[model samples]
Target: MKLFFQNKLYILAGILGLATSCEKEFFPQPPSAKVAKETTKLEASFTATPPLSLSDAYWKTADYLNIPLTDLSKNELYSDGFLNMTGTFKGLSSFNKGEDPKVMMKAAYDKTRVYIYIEWTDSDFSPEFAASIFNGPNDPLKPDTFRRWTSQGNSDKVALAFDIANASSATGTFDVVGCAASCHQNKMQTATGSVDIWNWDLALSDPLGFARDMMTDGTKGLHDDEGDNLASQNKIIQGNSRSAPIFEWDGTQQSYKRPDGKITLLDPGFYLLNKTPYIGDLDKGDKIYHDADYGCNHCHGEFGGGVGTIGEATAFASTGFAGKYSRASIKSYSASELHPGLSYWQKVPAANQDDLIAYIKGLGSIPGYYLKDPTGSSANIWSVSNVVRGRINTGSVHTNYKVILVRDLTTGNADDVQFLSPKGKSFPFGVALMDHDGKNHIGSLKHLLTFKL
Candidate 1:
């Protein structure tokens, strides 16, 4: 979907695909948080697949929407759209035969677009239909600052800043774009995607695009129906090549209309364009570093498979659902004895993940560090997992993937460092406090090498 914030357009369309499948490696697995923290360890199991069609009426609870409603329970909020759909898959008793529902939602802000997809096994779900979330009486997404919307029946138009990939010091800022969702129940109606071809003429410091004129009024809303939409931009289509445009970093002198109809342009730091060497290339080192990597089947277990509008869909209806994958869950790995809890990382923060993010973003390429995967290397997956972990910890936990330093603080030299998994399994690894050139840097974890299995 695309939106015209202030007169500048933002394109938000991204591929909704499965994550990189993993190989069963000798890599040590971590134990669950419950087992180590003395909390009750729960066991869970469930089935998931795409719903047969638009009217499969998935009755189970699923919360793909990230916004928490003030009045409704989690389940109630999830099922709200389901409650609105009137049809059901007539002959299908169950979606057990591998059919999954594919739900995709795409939204854009000023310069970026965000797409989320999920697959489940119910007919009640609607890709369209943006309702007011619990926080805002008439807005579908609340704590409404991060997002805005325009609706057309089963389809609710949206403009959102999917902040998941902001890697700079202005990490909170969003790459804005536009998108639309049609009612999934009504398969008869087709929902297409679009992009805004305008430049960022506002500030990038605020996440909501509030300081900019594009979002001040609802005029930033662009559509496929709009004759001169950015969707026609050949450069945008050739830039990213997956699902959306890869805008260029704002450095050139470009002027755009503000929401109030004023003319303005932004500085170099305001926007980033994807002018990588591999333009129009899909399945490159960068394609996997996207939000749509988690498709419907990959998330909500036992539900239909569909791209989500935003956020991850409910893999398990109950908290128990996650219990089934306890070994793979974040809580399991972060609190495990082998990985050392949050406290341990705080005592000696080795790696500066923020610096790492800067380093990665500095490369101006997706999957910047681990560029290729010819050996089907786990490095890119590992980097993504590590980066995600660092974001969650907000600079607390450190591990082999995120380790910054393993050298003696006194000597500040390369040293034999030891690493542990969540299960307390020892792994052979080396750490050092070094600078960009691998020279010793004061109080930082710089060099890391691993040979452990």
Candidate 2:
């Protein structure tokens, strides 16, 4: 249900304060090793038309609260094996160690949608997600792929969790432990309840203008709520022990059409719209370059860079070249065209060129996940991240992400949380902000969203 869970939770009332809020007055509670305590409340003041963008006037009408946060670095207690990797959180950039990022939040509601806005400072602008790096034949993602997913380069993320029932687990109440009530040893679940999760994945769902709507119950634990499958891994299993990407860009039309009839410009280095499945002979491609007699790595190293160009190594995930798509784009129609100046450029066979294309396009790094038009109940939350797509801030100051999320007030799904008026004006919730980490986050807890009745 939750992509990443932190022992620390922050509740900034966009008055959708943590994606939900409480009244503005906050009473500090004793801090624990993980969670920072806050008694926060905010009003989801009514709006005629719920705003979905940060520029909407709804922001002008409501007051945002400054919430406290705890540096829950490696929340390993109930992480289900997911842990924040120290020193690598910022990917290729230097982490701003002493800057106490000021976290702010606010919210609003209309007849159909509930909205929340949260923003914070980050030292680095990490927009790349997990990329399929060519780690020879021993990459862990080579399927049987169970757990321990880390982004060689990463992006910023925010999430909100709300209770769907009178819930309890691990001897804690939803009102008390917040998300911990449902998080367990190896899975995210409530001992006796369910939760509605609004996960804003920067690289995954944001491109589709959505916050993945998900849920977790006492039984099945966490899962994507039924509907159109929006995004999934771009990998395919080639028998066992070996795996490769299933799709790649075939053309240069920026706005490629989706199977569902929606057309959107695919983010370069982040998405693949034109699709061509792997139909070439890998054996032919391998022998032409990596073969002992041919040896592409002799000059370009294992995958791309070697003696003269170690700084440009294609196989390793580094700062500017983290994800498969990071700094990788489609052009010129030929792999040899990518490096025409190199020796033996024309020596490669056209019939086996795809293997080189796959090696260069697929190997230099590729999207860890692919986007599709979502369907069904899964499309509940519509989101807009106020950031320029496909561009990273290399300037002196890091950018602060202003993310806006909107969802139906009462999604009639059994697994989702409902916030009907009158009896349901105030709902307690938890929310988190990850700089570059998936598991560990800085967040606020105990914020209640009170709809202005």
Candidate 3:
């Protein structure tokens, strides 16, 4: 009996061992499936060359790229004919995340040869399609394949627009307008003649309103010059190159003294920054009005400086002066009465002059040229995001993805207002700001660059 019992126990033990081995073999987990590799990075690069000017004040540095007008010296003596800006850039990204890109301006100069660099990332990328467009009355329709150019504005405005991809990354790339190859065929040839200097692209999105407020005095409901409020009556004195005037006067009430002498205007009205010139109604062919009377030639220097019977001033005043009988209606304002060349004349085609003025009007006045400054973090910014969707087909499921609007600060704003990328990099889905809407109050001042460390 003992032997039989011991044999039974051994058999039972063997059966239990077999069961344990089967459980270990069947229930063991397989190594976790390897994770999929990340997609290759996207990248880009950009470059630019700026123009230089003769005056030192025109010699801009990165510091002025985003300066406030209030900080600008009130004295008309220290004017930089206009702000110039430039920059170098870098970026990297994945799957074209499609977020709003940011950028920074690095430098400013008056010289024409400006050097700029932009870099971004992508599996396949090219700078060939990247381009720029200056949005004024002059710019052609967007996606502007032809990139047409028109006449400049009264203030000699120039804007630089850039198209960029992979904007958030350090290797992102960009291209600017108002440069070679990208400019319009006819417009490029006549670029110097075109105006509309406001560079909305260079300004930050938030403070655009502030910039407009100060320049146009939009918030204060004020304008640059009218009656006695202007630093200089509409009269632009010889030797005065600064933008803001040094003196204010009512043409009829007081004599405008150049630091050296006092003079009276044949037309005793204040020049309006926003309104049309007093002689707007004058016909295009009327030889009576010359450019100097409007003070355009004072800074520009008569087209070729060729000697002429009527100086720019005499020519301009001629329309008002014409026949001697109507003296009281239009005073006897003569180049001799004030100073000979003070009212010098230079002749240009009326069509060309009108075109030039038309361009200038599009750019608006000096302060009005740039986009307004930032208002607040929430007010002047935007965000973008990436998302995915699932689709099922033929007993299988596939995943799809897309970029979506995460946030938009530009809503409810006019076309002129929008947020700029942090460093001036382009955002594929980013907002396009008007001359009055952006981060830094001032837009890209032609050759200026606001660099950040």
Best by lDDT: 2
| Residue 452 C-alpha lDDT in model 2 | 77
Candidate 1 lDDT over residue span 318-405, tens digit each: 2112212211242344346664223322332223322222211222212101011111110100000011210121123222211010
Which residue window of length 10 is worst by lDDT in model 3?
125-134
Measured over all alpha carbons after superposition, the RMSD of each candidate to the real structure, in angstroms, is: 33.1, 14.2, 25.1
- Per-residue lDDT, model 1, residue 378, is 9
RMSD in angstroms between candidate 1 and the native structure over all alpha carbons:
33.1
Quote the lDDT for 423 in model 2: 33
Q: Model 2, stretches more than 4 Å misplaced? A: 1-39, 71-98, 136-153, 238-242, 254-264, 279-287, 290-302, 306-343, 391-397, 422-424
Per model, how many backbone clashes are there?
72, 31, 103
Task: Give the candidate number with the greatest TM-score.
Answer: 2
> How far does residue 369 in candidate 1 sit from its true spot (Å)?
23
Question: Following a full C-alpha superposition, what root-mean-square deviation does model 2 have from the true structure?
Answer: 14.2
Q: Candidate 1, after superposition: displacement of residue 157 in Å?
A: 8.0
Please give the CA lDDT of all the candidate structures.
0.19, 0.59, 0.22
